[model samples]
Target: MAENKTQATGASVDEFLAAVEDSVRHRDGLRLLALMREITGKEPEMWGPTIVGFGRYHYKYESGREGDAAAVGFSPRKASLSLYGLMYGPEAAELLPRLGKHKTGAGCLYVNRLEDVDQAVLAELIKAGYRHVTTALHSP
Candidate 1:
C-alpha cells in the first residue's frame, strides 16, 4: 500500500503554529494546542506540515491496510479550522449540537472561527473522538 502522506513528523509544533500567517488562526491554534493537550494528556506534535495532533492510535482494516494515526488533531487552515476524528466517534452527533456553528464532513469538523463555537463543547468532542478510537482498539 502507498504510504500515508500525513505521517507524524518530528517537526516543532510551536514553530509550525508560529508560522501560521493568519493571526486569528494562529491564536486559535495555540488555544487548541492547550485544550487538546489537556484533554488527551499528551503533548502536541506535528502531523505532516500542518496538523497539530495529540496522541496516536494504530488502525487495521479487513483488507490488511494498517497505519497509525493521531487520536485527535486539528489544522488551522486558511479558510477554517479543520478538526479531525470528531465524526469518527458515535458521540459526535450528540456533542455536535452543542458545538455551535460548524460544518461536518465524514471525519472532519470545520469551523470558520473559534469564537463561533463553544470551546467547552469542542473540548468534549475531541475527548469523545479520542475515547472512541482508543476504546474500539481495545474491544473485541
Candidate 2:
C-alpha cells in the first residue's frame, strides 16, 4: 500500500459543500448534496479539497505510522460522485448486488446520481464500513 500522504484535516464542512455547489454548475449535484446529508447525519468535511468526508477514523499501520481519515466519505467529481467506503475487498462483493446500480473500486463507489441507487442501502453500506474500520482499529 502507498503512504497516505494526502491526509485530510482542518476544513469546514459547510464551506466545503458551498464551494462544491458553486463548482458543480449543474442541477444533478444538488440531489447529490441532499443524499449526502440524508445518509450521513454529520455534515461533510473538506478532505484535500476534493473529498467531502462524513465521519472520521484514526488508523495505525504496522510501520507505526498513524493518521486520521474520514471513516466514510465521498467526492463530487465532474463525471460521477465518488462515494468512499465499503470496499469490494471480498467483504463488499456480496453486498454490491443488493446495493443497486453503481461501480465499486478499491474503496470508492462511483455513481452518476442519487436517483439511480437505494439511499437506504447506501446507509447500510456506510454503517458497515464504519463498524468494520472501527473494529479493526480497536482490535488487539
Candidate 3:
C-alpha cells in the first residue's frame, strides 16, 4: 500500500542499511546479516523499504499472479523484527520451542531482540524456510 515510499532502497547494501536508521534495530540487522550469510552464503538485498532479503524465488498464484520474491528475508520494524519465513509449514513447527521468545504471523516471525532468541534456532528456522520454499518451487 503506502510502503513503497519508505526510502529503504538504494544501489548498495550499505546505503540500504543506512536508511534503516534505528540504532538497536541496526545491530539486530547486522546480526541477521551475519547469520543469513553464514547459512545461505548470499549477500542481503533490500526487497522493499524495510525488508532485507537473501536469495530469491518465483511463484505463480492460482489466481494467475506471478512474481519474484526473496526465498528468505527479515525486516527490523519499530516494535519488533519481522522475519520473512514464507510460511513456517510442517517442519518449522518443531523449531518454535527452541526459537526462544517470538510471535508468528502468516509468513513472518516477530522478535524483539536477537539475544532474546536462540541464534542456532533462528538459523535452523531460516534454513527450514529456504528448504520449504525451494521444495515448493520444484513441485508439480
Candidate 4:
C-alpha cells in the first residue's frame, strides 16, 4: 500500500501562518486557528506542509489501507481556504446550505473569504465534523 504522504509534522504553526504572503489569508488563517482551537480544544499541528490540523484520528479501510489523519483541518491556499473533514456526514449535508457562499470538492469545503460565510454555521460544521471523525470514524 502507498503510505499517506500528508503525515503530521513538527513544523511551527505560528511561523507558517506568519509566512502566509497574502494579508487576507494570513488574517483568516489566524482566525481559523483560534476557531478550530476553541472548537476542538486541541492545539493546532501542521499536517505535512500546509494544513493546520486539530486533533487526530486513525482510519482503516476494508481494502486494508490504513492511516492516521487530522480529525479536522484547513489550508489557507492562495485561491481559497481548503477546509477538510467539514463536509462529511449528515450534519454537514444539513448545514452546508446555510453556510453562506462556499464550494465543495471531494471531502473539502472551500471558502474564498471569511466574510463570505456565516461563521456560526462554519463553527457548527467544524464541531460536527470533529465529533464524527473522532468518535465515529476513528479506529480503536
Per-residue lDDT tens digits for candidate 2, residues 49-78, read: 777666667778788887778766777677
Q: Whole-model lDDT, candidate 3?
A: 0.76
* lDDT, residue 23, candidate 1: 94
Model 3 scores worst on lDDT over the 10 consecutive residues at 1-10
Off by more than 4 A, model 1: 138-140
Model 4 lDDT, full chain set: 0.93
Minimal lDDT window, size 10, model 4: 131-140
RMSD of each: 1.9, 3.8, 3.8, 1.0
TM-score of each candidate structure, all chains considered together: 0.94, 0.72, 0.84, 0.97
Checking candidate 4 for backbone clashes, the offending pairs are: none
lDDT (Cα, 0-100) at 71 in candidate 2: 65
* TM-score of candidate 1 against the unseen true structure: 0.94
**Tens digit of per-residue lDDT, candidate 4, span 106-135:** 889999999999999999999999999888
Largest TM-score belongs to which candidate? 4
Q: Kindly indicate the candidate among 1 and 2 with the higher TM-score.
A: 1
Cα error, residue 109 of model 4, in Å, equals 0.3
For all candidates in order, the CA lDDT equals 0.88, 0.66, 0.76, 0.93
Candidate 3 differs from the real structure by a C-alpha RMSD in angstroms, to one decimal, of 3.8
Off by over 4 Å in 3: 1-10, 138-140
Candidates ranked by lDDT, best first? Answer: 4, 1, 3, 2
Q: Which lDDT value does model 3 have at 42? A: 71
Q: Which 10 residues in a row give candidate 1 its minimum summed lDDT?
A: 131-140
